[model samples]
Target: MTTIRVQQHAFDPGAEINSFCARNPTSGGVATFIGQMRDFRGPTRAEGETVAAMTLEYYPGMAERQLDDLVKQARERWPLDDVLIVHRHGPLVPGDAIVLVAAATAHRSEAFAACEFLMDWLKTQAPFWKKEATSDGATWVEAQASDDARAAKWKK
Candidate 1:
């Protein structure tokens, strides 16, 4: 089973994983990744400015299609038993959950790899724009070169 959901509300990653693992009887291992809102900006947290919240925007139909395509590619490349993806949009405060991903497989390697693959793809490929709200001002976030490089590692 491949489950993908784009929602505006928050989600619990632990519950999501438990539900998936409980339903998928054949999975011997499960891996998960959660993306969260960070409170700092600049070179590093210690030196960066404090951020209050972030607002994310996306075209609903297009975003879902993009996510489905990534899931399809993951399924093609791995012997995954199941995968779960849940992403939240709209305004979010620091420490809030932004996305959740879980990949289940017969072994730890597959589970871990697939879980990372989903997150890496989502970071670079997902169609969403984020605006960070700080006490001073708000700014749109650009994808970092580090994220691009990470995603490119699994390129075809």
Candidate 2:
């Protein structure tokens, strides 16, 4: 099964991973990645060294569709028993979990690779925009070429 959602509430990584692995007797390993809100800043926010809060914005339909596609691609490439992706939107503080990717497979290698692949693709391709509230003010962070480059490596 594949599950994807954009929620305002926080998620429990253990529960999410366990739900994905449940009823999958063939899965020998499960890998999970959780992304957190960090104190990231650009030139505009250099004056503010800390991220007080952040709000994630997304085109509801588009974001879900893009994530669904990535999950499907991962399933095709690996013998995955299950995959679950959940990304939270709305205001978040530093250290809050922003996203979660969990994958279950028969082998550890496949599980690990698929988890990494899902996270990389989501970082580059997902249509979510983030605005941070810093000491200076709120600003939208631009996407970097490095993120695209990281995702491109999965194609090879």
CA lDDT of each prediction against the hidden true structure: 0.90, 0.87
TM-score of each: 0.96, 0.90
Candidate 1 residue-wise lDDT, 23-51, digit = tens: 98888898898888899988899999999
Candidate 2 deviant stretches above 4 angstroms: 40-48
Give lDDT tens digits, candidate 2, residues 1-156: 888988999888778767677757678998999998887565454654677899999888999999999999998899988888999998898888899998888899999999999999999989999998877899898898988888999996
Which candidate number would show the highest lDDT if scored against the true structure? Answer: 1
Runs of candidate 1 exceeding 4 Å displacement: none
